[model samples]
Target: MAITAPIATINDHSVRILAWNQIGSWLTYTDANGNSAIKYQFWDGGTDANSGFIWNDAGSGQLAANTTLEINAADLSQVWVRGGAAGGSETMWVRAFDGSDWGSWDSFTLTTIPNSRPVATISDHMVKFDQWTRVSNWLSYSDGDGEAATRYQFWDGGTATTSGYIWNDGGSGQLAANTTLEVAASEINNIWIRGGSAAGSETMWVRAFDGHDWGNWDSFTLTSQPNLAPVATIGDQSMHVGGWARASNWLSYSDPDGDAATQYQFWDGGSAGTSAYIWSDVAGGPQAAGTAITVAANDVSKIWIHGGSATGTDTMYVRAYDGQAWSAWDSFIVTSQNTSPVATIEDHSVHVNQWVRASNWLSSSDPDGDAITQYQFWDGGTAADSGFIWNDAGSGQQAASTAVTVAASDVSKIWLHGGAATGAETMYVRAFDGYTWSAWDSFNFTTVTNTAPVANIADHALHVNEWARVSNWLSSADAEGDTITRYQLWDGGTAGNSGYVWSDVGTGQQPASTVLEVAASDVPQIWFRGGSATGTETMYVRAFDGIDWSSWDSFTLTTTA
Candidate 1:
């Protein structure tokens, strides 16, 4: 029986294949007679059956009618199926024979699936100076074909892949421009990046390949952080009062970025906001800052604390600044030691047996502004000398060293007596603050010799039987300014003789005894009568002070008839 050409149909119509990949399909043909044998021919390209080769597989010759056969592209040379364009149609010609007649070649086409390009995306990343960071951590990739990347390119600043670097699956090494490398997708995670010597923002480009085509160039910003701030440290320190507390003595600076400190600030208390007092000068009077003081790093020692006024403990805060930013605040203890007071004394002169106030020759001052609360007096330069310190009234006295509190009303009224011995003497004094005593201050005390008084009498001329005033005839003078306390008059040159000494009784002068004594106020009222003999009669008179008596003087009284 004559049979029409078997109708050619493909069993798997939706099957898609890649270039150079193997694909299996089932071929079915229709035959009218059940006993008719079927044969098929398969070829690729050219017109139907004129330009391609015939398939000679075991299943190519079919015996039964309406039978199915399996066809695989792996059986053909790789170049046969690879001739079609990517993601385009590939044609295969097939014809069937029903034992006697062969039908025109029937064509069946299969589509080649194109490979999806791997998409690469990179986000902006932050890098610190001199710090290394992983480049892959900021990169992501996707492939629609579920293929892994086989190659990678990195651009330092631009999207020119030929001028950038490449990495391979074996290891990371420098690759020439316009070069290719075979690298696994997992190996790309080893990529790392580090900021250069300078710190700033820059752009970088990257692309990945999925063994076929490279993805579009993806860019990202790599911002480098600024330099690190300096580190500040301070140690506790101790200083005496009236001394400056310098920052260089305790503060230290360091920086991880290798930068030096440019400026610094200081606070009085433990914290910067603790607006306390800090002085820049040794006087510490008006050059004070209640908040903070900022100065150059070179002048670190110029910054002084406020401990000069008094003695105690103080807390100070300090910080340093690099070219970029300031460091954290650091605190330290400033211990102010106590300072003793200073004593001073002046030389003094006094008369013998005179009492002088010791406090008048003694004075003191303290550098720490502490008050002089007490005083100690000594007879000599040292505290072990024997000297008398008398009370204000000169009633009570203490030998050698003696101390008195400032609270006493007469504390500074200390009395010292100049003894009868006339010469130079030394006295020592010391002042005490609340803390300690000052060094002894010695002073010279000189005593002057006493001089005796001089007695004088002018010669008196009076008529016989006439009473002339003798008050003006007797006068006294002293070199030491001593007052005349007593007077002696004699009729002759002997001190025991008393003549012309009269007493007033009952409104008239009466004859008096050979000797008479009277008060100094009554000396002016003494009246002397002319002696019976008018010739020159020598009368001697003398004056006496409390300490010494003056020499005797003589005067002549003349009577005329």
Candidate 2:
């Protein structure tokens, strides 16, 4: 193991030196341009002066092309350039001369201007707010000596820090000339500026220590201009109110700053821009204008608006907000709408012979405060077959035929003629909305409990071999105008009356009568044949009204055989 001392040469001149390590041998000198040039030379084994090593192939006299230099040769190296340009610095490399061998060349820089600091210029001083963009060619530099690179420190609220480049430097604020910078959307709201040499006219300061001398520490304000306000536009619209007319209608919009709409407002019905029509924010229900809408730069914003409930020649105004500001109101007009009238009919039940009439019947209502022009009534049932006729038939109020005209909001007395039948009857009616008829509504009326026909027969006397003959022998009268459907004749005591048992069939008695009508003269001949029994006989007769039978009427008759 042998330890060898190193030797070096520069400008082809040998300067007296001592114990130099082969790995590290450096020197510094001022060039004609006043720029500091540093060179490094190395050797594997050598001694001062009489050592066995010389720089650059010995007789070549200068450093080789591939020779290298170390800017910071110390094991721990910290470097900062200064004074090259206002707000700017530069780095350079030179050939290193070595005895019989050329070392690799490296670069270093000067950070000192005799009496001036670097100046900076930003390309975009005023940015449109609520938008994100890159500041290309944003910060430029101009130094009195020369320009190398610019290091920037950004501040949002106040002055930049004097300690280190902080804020949004994109990790490292030390950047080359004409480099682009990016600003976030959230950061461009109020204040933003770059601090460095050559950034702007604002006086920025820097400190550069060249081993012994320290540079000036002065603060320079970077160039800063307030951002412009975002631009927005809302489109006009027109439509009707309520029902199908008020659905899916929207107003168009746009914003230049690519802002999202956070609020929407509109007027109900009034002159545009007058504020006479109350302005209301659209949140939900009929007034909700939708949510989370965005527009691109110089592009249209397709924002939708719900017209809500409005009618007549309504003048409406609309505006949109992009979280920062509200756009001007856009105007539109809406036409009036017509509403349909509603029709209704009530249900009822009554005894037979009580006819359904106009007094208690159908009714109608109009929604648009308009009059129900007319009411049309219809009756359909089996009652029509059996002499059932509406009293309004002659007045053109017949079922399925006529419309009752009215000058008011409601029309009543629409019904069917409840016939003598023992059952239900149905009628339908509808109201006209001036333009069209409403949906038909139906009602049911029942006719029940018909009065049975009365059976009257006078007493009679006859011989066993003879039959009695009398005109108007049995007569029926019904209160409900019901005709006798059948006659029942029984020859016995009254049934369930006074302990007189009356049976449909008995000894020496004729069969009961099934005839709806019997000739007035021979009613007894049909019930008894030649007076078959020889004793006082009792006979009972009753009438049916198609629905039910009347109470039996008894007549006593003396008979001889």
Candidate 3:
């Protein structure tokens, strides 16, 4: 990028901006004005400054991690600038921000998810992991010395997810304690471990072993919780947990007095604690256990509880959001009691109740207490489900709280709605790329929302030929109370030059004119009107071989029939 003039001022600067999704690099600048750009730059850095501007590397500073500079505005006016080159793969992402916080938090990972078939490789005594593709997964030298008799295991629901993944010492080799046999992902979903080499008792160090970094990798005891089928996904620098979190401080306490929790409380925010905000209820009712909630794309969180009370009468709530605010009593359900109330999240149709992953339909549930008895998937709104299933069957019921593996093709536009009865209903749609379920659609209503839902539509195909009679038709609609009309223009095909006035090209429409086509040597145009000519009639500029439509840009058609 070539910089003009000796001084690039806020008033003068032009550039061809280069942008790549989230991150962009601009050959931007700074103004040596009343404010020391650096001091002033850093000054606004923490204040009201925008992160999008840093892409310019404005003599102000270097690009920070997890953020984009805000240069599109005059805030950085004195610092004249424009688009430049493209950044790296880690361009588009989120950085943490607070009205009063650091130069900006190290961007937040909106979706913490599980990668499909996470892979693992036994390395340096640790288990290294890898997701579907990018990002390595590995358990560094923690428990072991990175050597010897290491038995790697890739499991699901507690058994070897794949044949080759479950490797045991078989009392053959001797893996040392803390030898840290890190593992990397293989052709499996993911790799975790219960290895104490000498003790033989399984020690849990549960974290996605991405070949690169382990995000808040958690460790658990295999004895208390014997089985877990979790999913982890690595996006940009964002790592997520998709599987059910088997542990919860909330469930750890049980009142011997049976008085129930004097108060039910939960605080959600960064890392579940940092910058956390609290929510509590004074023994108003039973408290649900576990912090491990189902976090769908866009931060939608859900969980199933089997021990709120004995009777299965209370509502089964699934919490959700778009980008802001959380909903109370979002999901509902009805079921009996069973311990293994599996709550799973899958993209490809996973086995639920007892069905494979198909774009048509899939589901999740709590095996007992709040088992899934009904299924409803929304493509942004109730109107979007293809039939009733996400991929096929649109309506049904079951007895489990497991992920409904929607046919991969039916993702993105669909949503997850769970409820036991009807009063307290919880449901929200998420954004997907037909592969991974990223975040939930944040757009939701405050009360019993009846906002018009967005319809997922395939754009209609429009075509024309030399002997053109643009017979165009589109299947779209306005709100239940509104009308949407369709129109087209060849502009006489001067590429995009002519404007022979558009007219009524259809009948039974607001403008009652069924005049649709014109000959090769003729040109016709049409439009609609409400209170004129014939109450609601189609105005036209009839058969113009080469003539002005009319003084008013409209004319009567010379009827061929």
Against the unseen true structure, what C-alpha lDDT does each candidate score? 0.61, 0.43, 0.27
Model 2, 130-240: lDDT tens per residue? 222333334444544343323432332223332112234345343332233333323322222333322223333323322222334334334433232333333344432
Ranking of all predicted structures according to lDDT, beginning with the best and ending with the worst: 1, 2, 3
Cα lDDT, model 3, residue 158: 25
Q: Candidate 3 on 1-561: residue-level lDDT in tens?
A: 332221221211222223222221222233323222221121112111222223343464544533345442334433422123321111222221111222222221111122222222333222112111111234433322122212333222222222112222333232233343434334222322332222112333334433223434344333221111222211111111111221122123232222222222232222222111112222332233344234343211222122222222222223323222233422222222223322223332111111223223333333233323332233222332111222334634322222444443444334333221122222233323211343432222112112221212122212121122223211222233222122222221111212123334333222133334443222233332122112111233222212111111222221111
lDDT of 1 by residue, 294-359 (tens): 778876666655443345676777889886689988887877677789987798765666666776
**1 or 2: which has the higher lDDT?**
1
Error of 3 at 282 (Å): 60
Candidate structures ordered by TM-score, highest first = 1, 2, 3
In terms of TM-score, which candidate is strongest? 1
Question: Where does model 1 exceed 4 Å of error?
Answer: 1-199, 203-224, 227-305, 308-317, 320-352, 359-374, 380-387, 393-395, 405-412, 420-426, 432-436, 443-561
Candidate 1 clashing pairs? none
Model 2 TM-score, all chains together:
0.31
Worst 10 residues of 1 by lDDT: 46-55
